[model samples]
Target chain A: MHQSRLTRWFFQNVGLASALLLFAVLFLSYNMMHPRGFSAAVAVQNANETAAIAFLAMAQTLPVLLGGLDLSVGAVMTLTNCIASELVNGSPAQILFGIVVTLLSGAAFGLMNGLIVVYGRIQPIIATLATGAIAIGLALLVRPKPGGDVDGDLGWALTNSVWDFADTYGIAGGGDAWWIRPFADIPVPVIIVLLVTILVWVPFRRSVTGRTVYAIGSAEGAAFMSGLPIERAKIAAFTLGGFFAACGGLYLAIQTSSGNADIQQAGAYTLNSIAAVVLGGTSLLGGVGTAVGSLIGAGILRVISFYFRILDIDPLLQPLIEGVVLLVAVSFGAIRTLRVKNKLDLFR
Target chain B: MRISVSNENKPILIASLFIVVILLAGTVYTLSTAGTAPLLSPKYLLQQLQTGSFLGICAAGMMMVILLGHIDLSIPWTLTAAAMTATAVGGEMALPTALAVGIAVGMLNGFGVAFLRIPSMIFTLGVDTVLRGLMVAQTGGFAPQDTATPLMLFLAKDRLLGIPVALFVWAAVSVFIIVMLTRTGFGRSIYATGSREGAAYLSGIRTRFVTMGAFVVSGLCASIAGVLLAGYSAKAYQGMGNAFLLPAIAAVVLGGTHILGGRGRYIGTLIGVILIVLLNSVLSIMQMPEAGRQIIYGTVIIAMLLVYGRNQRVTS
Candidate 1:
């Protein structure tokens, strides 16, 4: 929303509100009903599960905003997770090196997608689908099974409470730790998520390349006519998307402390991320959304699963609920089309 | 007349030539490695067609939706749900129940894509998730623990005069689609609608009905395949249809059916299905691993699409 007056100006962007508002309501209600109300430990665990999908939804957000789709984000994550599990072990230096390699591999997969889509001129859906298949094949070649050792200490340090790191780094200053003690129980993954948002997404959203991405999504023809960097922006969107997917993959490796080369997992994550993107108030037609909205949408999805788990509902029915959520959100967006009086206007 | 026909059907002719090349390769590999001429053996070829029948049927449906410039991503679970429901119903009701389930899902897909104006890819994908959840919940994450009805067995396994009945089933669907595309006004309208829905609507095409009809046809095809698969296995199970999903689409696309929906030939699709079937069996004969098969499978689809799709440089 934006308003201008002679004396002052006011603006509010409600695009990111749906997912945030829904997640906030669902999260608070669930916390209220929980056995332990809003503990940092609980908060951390929620973040750990939500983080991977959040990263994935954020990944999906870029392509959707570019008026394209990436069905391979899950596959890329799966590939990198296997790589991380296989390499992120042994000596500390080896682990550090492995982590870098793993992250780079994710970027490489995204880069591959970008190349295929932009240079090869393949439709994004088909391009991503093909690349995704290759990624899964590679993942299977790497692990071939569900078991791999992520360094135990590393996984624990990353997944568990942040008390030790805070105290050691003296985030509260060297004088006293009392004020920060309560928050010390906050999980490292949650902080990593926040840091990623603040450090990466925020800056990217404000960048010229990001503006180009939005412009491309809204109207590629117009963007091209205006002499925008269409090819570079598209490639950038895919590479960044792949990088985020890799973050998801690494998180999975750390969270599970192992890796699985599961084909079903790739399909599941791809579909769910899409649903999250849709729920996040991003138009599938492209050109209208934010990573924050996608992040919140992801949170809302994970919360539905978590809330049901607390209620002790049958695990089998969980997907049904999630699917219904996706259907409703998708249809909710479609309501706009129904309002168009002229049938011809439907296409535009 | 012959020259004009050849020019119009160039893609199909190209794929047919590619099929021959693939067959030659298979023969060379088989004879050189296995010391067998099974690639050309009538018995072997017939058996392969029987296996291809299911994929052929599914692709037949997928091609219809794609022909309408829409995709049905719900095929996998729709097939499973149909098969599972059929087995659960059993006996005389099995066939009807399977078809009914498919029709219902198709109608929902049609409603969303046609009337609601939602994109077919995501809408059907959403429905796919819902179907998977419902099936898993229905079976409680285990096998359906049901036997194929006698009708399914007759349809899937019982050979007719030495050729598998499955081939006949595939043939029926092929004939129906060919007739629909070539012999019916509805089929022509599907092309018109796909080429440009607004133009088709303005021309009084009732484009929505055509779209819904295509989806319903697709659903029925998937349902038929599901029933046959369940019969072949003699039981219903979860995720049984997962394997067919992409291969079916691949077969359609490879057959020279345009992914963008409007221009394609049924004959090209038929040949494409045959190519996929032979390639798969040949790969197994060569003792390729599952992982390698997946890589080649994806590569083949992309390679074929690149050859023919020549997509416009736009994100949408």
Candidate 2:
């Protein structure tokens, strides 16, 4: 009985442990491929992709938890990036202001989504789809083409390593910069990602408000009857989603060193974010989830993308793979939910 | 079951939005185009109506599935398969035979969605990929070299009494669907299943049949749309169906349909389709870049959704 219980526990928690294992394997593979100069810079590039994807996944989680999905993350990112590039007026302060405005805009967007879902009584999917179209349209108005450049100094600072910490000590050597060179100097985006994991994810798991979100997601009527502020929690969840989307946009700007309104063209982010959330073992039907799971999900996605790049697969074929992966992930999630639904009155 | 009636009542407010969007599209085009009067021009509006009605034929069918709380993401490919099949086979046989083949493919889609227990969205998406691949492989990513019969071209190109034939087809299908939904046991079961699955099951609704029926209808609509479009464009090129997906969903939503299912209006969808086509044409006439046009389209739709939802709440 003890052995069986232990084995079940391992099976249940294996997702996260294996995620870390995959991350380690990715790094090892990279090292083996490039024997002499495989270093922190590569890790930083991977970090940047991981951070952006992670942030987007996190943003999407809140709405999905409430049985909603946000298709507008990419569009919102485009809008923010467009503004950051054009409205910054060539000053760091202005660029910072743009960043602030972007987050505010995201929050406002989320609030609208929540309002529509809760008060407007619109279906979450339809509401988001409508809003996503609007967001993309607005991004187009901001910059028809990918013309505007972010503040040069800010871009350099974000992308380039200033001080040699581990890399300088020869632990991971700093080298020439590529368009998406891993941040060797300061790696601010990765830092922000880590900070979010600590501050947001941890609190989200521990705090009452956070727990209530899970409860609401798992069973809204029960939570409502139990005196949890169901409506507020739902609104807060969507609003938080908006904020994270904005953060992801900022990280994306840093990664590419410029924002293309069309960069969000690929529908990869939306599906990938959902996949990441599910692969991290977050329940699709909402309620049971961990932020750490999303992180692992994000990591796995990045690794897969990197693996594809290393293998030199045609870019177009990637969508087919992504579509398949999305189907698989959703299938797994749906099955899991169905299994739980059979036993749990919570589904009602 | 009683509660869903109240829920269905909510979508009536979305009908009002169709009016708003149409008016908005009209107003925007009027102002931006510097008095083109294209909005009032029957010929121009007829063309827009015909283009959108091609999509409407499919939307009418999709609306049913959506009302039952499922979606058919594979309309793109179904249409593609229909188009390719018709175009490839139209040469050797009469048009009816080719159309039948296309419709049969749609039946297969219905089978996959209904009997296999696959989520319609995922199942269709996968099938869409396979269909797209088949289309590409068959045509080598270009229009086939079939010398289309004059009858085929005339069917595609000929306007009946100044209105496109496609519009007539669309009108017929829409009416057929409305009748089916309002008058049939199967249709009522769809509403029941969508509103509450457990209750539907308890009521002895053949939920799978109801669900599968929607896909079959959608498949049929898609093929019809493909036939119409293939006639209109004179070829069923790769990704011809791509532009239709968003607009189709938008038309449904704008028509007062709930994405979660159980409620929608066909007339509202018709209006939604008109509004979208009008918006797209006007935006193009204004020389907006692709990105700008997309952004504008997105913004207006989102704003409309919010307003529609809020208004519904206030009225209740």
Candidate 3:
């Protein structure tokens, strides 16, 4: 019986498992093709880029867990990035103030979305889409052009390896030999991701509010009937989502050392977040999956492009591959539709 | 078989009134500032109608899908792909090529949603990405060399009896759609399926087929719009269809159609199209930046949804 339960757990988390496996294989292939096998510099570069999308995916995962979608996460990230680039300059005190303001503004946007969906009774998709438009507008207002500067020291602090092995050990840019070293020496962004997973996600998953969110996603009517705090749970989930998106924006600001009001980039991030959440085994129908899975999912997505670059494949084919992978990943969940005994269940 | 305007349609009635108010507002603003003729002048109104015809054609198709309680977010890429294919083919084959591309995509979307039972939103989005990639690859990330065909240009630019031919095409398409929804059994099936698929299936309606048919119609309409758009611009360009998706959806929803499907009218959608076109012209006239325009569009949709969409029962 114990063995059966273990097997069932394995089967249930197959999406996460596959995502991890895919990431590993792609990372290996990329390292093989790259002139520098797995140097610290390369690791830092990868971590910095992946962390942003991973954060956005985590934000998306929260809403999906509550049986809703938040299309505005990407826009919130863009808005915060713009704000950060504009304010995160000069003195250390000013940078700290800018970070707080950016995060608060992101949360404010999320609160607005939550209110619209909860109080205004608008559908999540449409409500978030509307708010996303507004967020993009705000982002454009902050930085009409991509010319703002972020604090160089802050950017270096976030993007560089926590321990500079290259400088300390006399290794030139931590040259290709340290591929086998543990991920402990990974970049600060990777550390931030780990911290977030342990600190924010773990506590939230165990808390009553998190369980309430799951309950609402699984069966809102039943949860409402049970007198659970459905409204509070939903609002909290969206607010948390906004907070995470702001984290992503901060990462982006540090990575680029600037801001851009590029709608295309925001749109790409939004679509990719949905794809990552699905690949991570989170059901779009809601009430399933975890943030860790989405992190791996984001890694898988990023590695695919990285792998393509290593192989010198045309960049145009990247979207095609990504789309196919997303469709296939999503289709895995749909396979259950064939087994529905009652035709009506298919609609649900 | 004419379904009378019921109490549920009061929102649409109010929307019609709102359109008039906006028209007057736009005219007054234009007249006061530039001392130009009112935008309500026949020539200006005709121009606005002509511009609206492009959106109207696409929205007409979108309305069918919305009526069935499903959405096709793939419209932008599908429209772009069709336009690219048509222009690349050039000459007399352009129209047919575009229509074929639309039908093909529509069928693909239909198969996934109806047969495989995948969610339309995600499935169409995936298809859209793939199409976008393929189009980019074909164009080598640059504007295509081929331009719109002679026939397409004539259809888009030439006028008959002082009205744009595009307007006439839109009228013809509108008449067909209105008849399909009001008089045909297929139309009835679409409404029945959208409102409640299980009940419709139990009553011996082919719900899957109806669902597929709605997607096909939507795809076809989107492709036609792409052709017209290319004709208007004289050439196909990358990301040409990007601007239409939100506007098409907003028009459908603003027309008082339930977002989850079942109840709506083409006449209301027609009014919605005019309102959007006029609104676009006014915003442009005011020289508002792109960001302001997007904010206004989003705000208007939210406000309209609060008034009309909130009350409808979403069976899906």
lDDT of 2 by residue, A1-348 (tens): 999997886677665555567657766786566533265577656666677788988887777777667777766766666666665545557776777887788778778777767776766777777777777767777777777766655655554343343334233343433522454445656677778778876776576667778887777777877887667777888777878887777767756656677633624466567667766766656776666777777877677666665666665566456556544544443343444545322113
- Winner by lDDT between candidate 2 and candidate 1: 1
lDDT of 2 at A12: 72
Q: What tens digits encode model 1's per-residue C-alpha lDDT throughout B91-124?
A: 8999999999999999999998888888787899
| Candidate 3, DockQ score (0 to 1) | 0.48
lDDT of 1 by residue, A1-348 (tens): 233551241113344665676778999999999998698768877878888998999999999998888989999999999999998999989999989999899988898889878888877877788788888988889989898998877887787677755544456663247886666777788788788888888898888888999998889989988888889988989998988999999989988989898998988899889878878878787898888888888888889888885797888898898788878767765767767898698854
RMSD of 1: 3.1
Number of the top-ranking candidate, with DockQ as the measure: 1
Q: Which 10 successive residues of model 3 chain A have the least lDDT summed?
A: A167-176
Candidate 3 lDDT, B122-141, residue by residue in tens: 78888998898889788888
Q: Per-residue lDDT tens digits of candidate 3, residues A156-206? A: 667878655333444544433564255436787888899978998889888
- Candidate 3 residue pairs in backbone clash: none
Candidate 2 lDDT over B1-316, as tens digits, reads 3634344344455545555666566666677658556666778878777777777877787787788777777777777667767777766463665467556655655666555455565456656665665666567667776534455566667889887877778888988887887888877787887887667766787766677677778778887787777777787667767767767887887777777677666667766676777777777666777767776776667666665544232110
> lDDT at B248 for candidate 2?
87
DockQ of each: 0.56, 0.35, 0.48
The DockQ score of candidate 1 comes to 0.56
Largest lDDT belongs to which candidate?
1
Classify candidate 1 by CAPRI docking class: medium
lDDT of 3: 0.85
